[model samples]
Target: MKKEMYAFVVPCSARPLVFDESRCVGCNRCAEVCQVDILIPNPEKGRPPVVLYPGECYYCGSCVMACRQEGAIRLQHPLMNQAKFVPVRHAADAGEEKPLPAEKRRG
Candidate 1:
């Protein structure tokens, strides 16, 4: 009899979801609630679900919300997808009265 080895490749650059092994209960709820079907239940009992298609994840946080265990599952959006906050200067702060559009300006 011969034994075969199987390997699953997960992209290193982007991990849309992360599992906290210590906190995970492996109830498979996360996998069930995934709208994109990117996650699958692990064959081994009491182990975290597998991220079969990390790239296919919608980053919708459904899995995290479905999990009963706190900190068991988390959504990690890629750097490009993360939100950035920019400070905006109001017209008063800038000390400028911007002209309105010609159509909107009063005669």
Candidate 2:
């Protein structure tokens, strides 16, 4: 049986964002949108961008949205590989359709 409705049903207690250094095209698009209140500029040099407030991330998918490369930005949620995503049953579970929290749903 599935566990109780977790305000944070996510598996990992704390997960960090992982980047593909090679895939990053240095478009700086992710950095642009994140300037307001999303992320901090990563000084590292690579395809995958970096951030400051990783834990504070709202998972808005903006960085990924601005990504022009194939595999530039990737979200590596905590206990992701170990976690299994069960489809949302009721109307409450379904929030947005376009980006259905791929990391959370990846079983």
Candidate 3:
């Protein structure tokens, strides 16, 4: 009989959680607060928890919110999920004639 081994790998782009070791207190709050159970507490004391399944993250920011140390944990949304804003221009701003008011407008 032969023994079998397995390993799990995560792509860099799929990783959604970032831990700042310098700022992290290693309290394991992030692991405890993770809604998806992707984060695992490090067995070593005073070390940041490990991200077990980065691709499974929900980007809910619960881990970041639960961390007592500021800037310890940060949640990154995928590019497709990020919000984009474009400046809006009114008709007058674009040099277009404004439509006649149906009735006199009151302030």
Candidate 4:
């Protein structure tokens, strides 16, 4: 028998990354090391990597470390050291009791 499966949707930062063209050398190291496989290297030479799927990024800075060229890939401020996992509830879950306001909320 086949087992059941479920999927969850989550919200993440929109502008999660920025590639410094001046620092990148088209070596494709960053693309190779990314855990989420978001970075895509250009076919042409001397071009910076592209973030194909920014929302899936884990912001682990593996790309930054892999870059020996200095400041080639930056994960942006506010989201640099911060990673948010917002669980999106479906319509079926809307009937659940909502949390109380901060002033009335219990510890």
Candidate 5:
């Protein structure tokens, strides 16, 4: 069965995301990883990822991690004004809600 997408709330007080189409490599890894279904893949065109619902973002940084590009995705925290280009692994590791990746075994 297909999972239902949610309208997750993204806290923009930290800062907002910067869209750089130039850095995007048309990878939909972010959309795949997003449980909330915030991002959608552009299949018709070059197949780049687009933020379908920014409000649904949990700010978990899963999208940033899924993005292979160095500066393709960024995380904007409430304490910071500009979104920082944090490594996906590091951001996933920082979150206590879930494990870094599905490949990583939890004991």
Candidate 6:
């Protein structure tokens, strides 16, 4: 049977966490501590964990705390502020969406 599909873009209440691939050691500790289950181990060992559900991220920093590699994973609020309006790519749209300022973040 032929099938059709549609896609939608979602804006988040708060910024999602960020990962530094260069600093990540693929230990999976961050995935272990994520309360929302957004992170999962990479299929190949010795690779950084993947964001299984970006929308489910709470920016709780549990993953950051669990990381043995300093500066590997961190909250996006501080980084966003310092970066001065970084734009994130959305699959559904050609234009990038700007991240909300830290003061505007709900959670």
Task: Tell me, by TM-score, which candidate is best.
Answer: 3
Assess the local accuracy of residue 5 in candidate 1 as a C-alpha lDDT between 0 and 100: 66
lDDT of residue 10 for candidate 3? 55
What tens-digit string does per-residue lDDT give for candidate 4 at 1-107?
A: 59896333344566666778888898999899999887677767888876777778866888888988878777764535557778765433666454654342222
Measured against the true structure, the TM-scores of the candidates, in listed sequence, are 0.69, 0.50, 0.74, 0.57, 0.52, 0.56
Off by over 4 Å in 4: 1-13, 77-107
After superposing candidate 1 on the true structure, give the runs of residues whose Cα lies further than 4 Å from its correct spot: 1-7, 10-12, 86-107
Tens digit of lDDT per residue, candidate 2, span 2-105? 97742322333555556677777666778787644444445555444445455566666777777788677776655654577786464336654544654443
Q: Between the candidate structures 1 and 5, which one is better when assessed by lDDT?
A: 1
Among all candidates shown, the one with the greatest lDDT: 1
Per-residue alpha-carbon lDDT of model 1 for 1-107, expressed as tens digits?
A: 58896537466579888899999989999888888887777889999988978878877888888889999988988988789988865665667677874343222
Q: What TM-score does prediction 6 earn?
A: 0.56
Error of 5 at 97 (Å): 42
Q: Quantify how close model 5 is to the true structure by its C-alpha RMSD in Å.
A: 15.0
lDDT of 2: 0.60
Candidate 6 per-residue C-alpha lDDT over 1-107 given as tens digits, one digit per residue, 9 for 90 to 100 = 58895333344555476678888889999898889877778878877887767677756778888889998876766444555556764533655455654342222
Which residue ranges in model 5 land beyond 4 Å of their true spot? 1-16, 78-107
Cα lDDT listed for each candidate: 0.82, 0.60, 0.80, 0.73, 0.64, 0.72
| Candidate 2, superposed: residue stretches over 4 Å from native | 1-13, 35-38, 42-48, 80-107
Prediction-by-prediction clash tally:
0, 2, 0, 0, 4, 0
Better of 5 and 6 by lDDT: 6
Error of 5 at 72 (Å): 1.0
Model 2: per-residue Cα lDDT at residue 52: 48
10 residues in a row with least lDDT, candidate 2: 5-14
User: Which model, 1 or 2, shows the larger TM-score?
Assistant: 1
Worst 10 residues of 1 by lDDT: 98-107
**Model 2 residue pairs with clashes:** 21-47, 24-47
